[model samples]
Each structure stands twice: as structure tokens, then as C-alpha cells.
Target: MERRLKISSGERLLDRALDEGIALEQECGGKLACASCRVVVLQGMHHLVAASEDEVDMLERAGASAPNARLACQVRGTGDIVIEIPDAELPPACAASSPVRVTPRAARHLAAQLNKHAGAVAVRLAVERSGCSGFSYRIDPAGAIGDGDAVFESHGVRIAVDAASLPYVQGTLLDLVREGLAHRLQIDNPNVRESCGCGKSFSARSS
Candidate 1:
């Protein structure tokens, strides 16, 4: 059985759970050295703040790279969010043979997005625990440089990424393709060893 916890602004999900007298695991003393406090975010993603580099590293090692998987200790701020603490162990790393890339058109498209959002710096790319393949990307507009984030620029367009997302998207080739009068981003990732039939997520090719 799972229980919901109430939290306020500036409060962390894990802290609220502990303060509410819930028995939660903390194998690494909440230092993010161990991936013991993994949680599957059910809803309210925009309201929840982004995770840090260390937290992303821990979660990636645990193979919880879906769009919804987040370390409890890394979750910040208070929002009406739903999450499930899972009983699991840290998994292995995803190794890629190359680096991430983007097409000229995709770069231009991304730049357009940055221009649309006033003061936006770039686009942030991260992996979330999602899809049948156990992993997916969570991309969004970036307003500033984040802690431990890798910034990539091409054709004057920038895309920020966390260390955890490196292996999964290293060999990725991003393009902005036009489909039936609609333009959308397309990703041709070589690190994907397997993907679900629906094509919403992917699994890393173990090296």
C-alpha cells in the first residue's frame, strides 16, 4: 500500500514523508550515493522542480530513466503531486559509442523556440522513467544554466543535458521533420537497443 503526503513550498518530497512519520528507505543517508529512494511521479510534473545532476546520475544507474522516475531526495518544492516509492536496486550504466548530434533544421527550430520564450537560454534534455522500454526523454525550455548540466550549441541553437542523459542520447540525431502540414522533432538515436512497439520509449544497448 502507498500513502500520500502533504507538503508546502520549499519542502522536499522525502522530507515531508519523513516528517509525516512514514517509514521510507534511505540507504545512502539521502546523499544520492545509493538509489534507494526511487519514486515514480504520477502527475504534476510542471509543478515539481527539476532534479539535480547527482540525482539524475543515481536514477540513471538504477535504470529508472523514464520521464517519471525521480529520486525522492532530489524532488523539491511543494505541489499537488503524486508519486510511488518503489522497492528496487540500482542498476547498471548505459554506454554509447558516440556523441549526440542535431540537424541544421532542428537547430533552427530549437532556436525559434528559444526566441519565442523571452529570455530563454536553451532547451534542457533529460531522461524520465517512462514507456514500455523503461526510458524516455523529458525536454523543455531552459532559461539558465543548471548545476552540472552540459550545454550544446549548433547553428546558434543550444540544448542542455544532464550527465544521466548522455549515454542514452549520445548517438542521437535530432531533426525537425514536417508531417502532413505539421512540423515535429524527430530523434534518430543509435543508443536505443530496443524500443516498444508504440515507439514512445527505448532501452539502452548494454555494452
Candidate 2:
């Protein structure tokens, strides 16, 4: 959808596009923390401001190092410019009723772990904004379902998640992965777009 617009001097590209009713994704509210607002400059690149070192590093980390790629939030246009907004719209979040599956092996493993903590009713699974990749999963033994918590049961084991964490983890599968002699618990999430190299954090495809 190519549309012509008159860009003013020092006008932020994101603001202008949004004002024109473009649904560009800015997951971090244009804070440069997420590269969801990346746009490919088709022409008039010279009219746009150069990207800062921070923005460059962030784009690199996000694997958006195209020659013409630019963060819509980071650049301002001084004149008419042609740019293409990629079809990188975030995936729609799953409904609250969507279930997070737990494999039988994971259920048994988690059950044993929960048994060690007396009175623990379920394992709380939540996501927090952390690490370079955007979010990290937090797990804790939940004693009770708190306010705005959604509870799910699988194989006699219950998993509790806060309302805020539900979208990022919906349709996720909890499994026990074995590699040679090593074994670890893994989260197979459908909403995750990319993960940190160390596997400690992930960036979700958010709407």
C-alpha cells in the first residue's frame, strides 16, 4: 500500500505514518527496545536522519541489518521520502481460554518438584520484560491463584499464569528435552519470534 504524504522538516516517521492510519507495530512504544517498527527505505534515504549507535546495535541484535532497514521511531524525515513498511505485524494474541500444553514427561517432572514444597498448589508461569531479547519466563511454586490469574490443568498438574503473561505464552508446550546425557525443561512457545543465544530470554510476536 503505497501512499503519498507531505513530510515536514524533522517529522518523526512513526508519528506521521500513524497519523495517516498506518498500523505500524511499536511494541516498546517507540523506545527502540523492540525492532517491530523497522521500515525499508525504498528511496529518499538521504532525507532521513542517520540512525544512532544505540539504534544500530539494537537492529543488529534483532537481526534487522538490511542496508535500507531503519527504525521508524529513530528516524525523522526532512522531506518527501519513499519507504516500505514490511508486513511484520505482530501475531494476534491467543484468547484467554487457550490452553498451555504440558507434556506427560514434563507434568511428571514438575509434579515431583512441586511435591517438595508443602502446600504448593501449582507452578506459576509468567513473563517479565528482561534481557536483550525482550522477555524472560519466571517460574515459581504458587500457593494459591492470585487476582487476575488464569489456571490450567494438564495430566493432574495445574499451571497458573497471570493475565498479562497469558498472551505471550498461549499455546505453549512444556516439555522435558534430553540431549545425550543432559536433560532440561523447555518451553515450546508458538508466539516467540526470536530468543537470546543463551536461551534465557525471548522476544514474542506481540500485537
**Candidate 1 segments whose C-alpha is farther than 4 A from its true place:** 1-97
TM-score, one value per model:
0.51, 0.53
> What's the lDDT for residue 52 in model 1?
74
Q: Per-residue CA lDDT of candidate 2, range 77-113, in tens?
A: 7888877876643222243345776766788889999
- Number of the top TM-score candidate: 2
Query: Candidate 2: global Cα-lDDT?
Result: 0.80
| Candidate 1 TM-score, true structure as reference | 0.51
lDDT of 1 by residue, 1-207 (tens): 356656699788889888878667789888887777788777776667888755764554455646788877878877777777665433333334444556667777888787888988888877777989899877788889878877776456777878777666764657778899999988776667788999889887533
lDDT of 1 at 190: 63
Candidate 1 C-alpha error for residue 205, in Å: 2.9
- Can you give the lDDT of residue 90 in candidate 2? 23
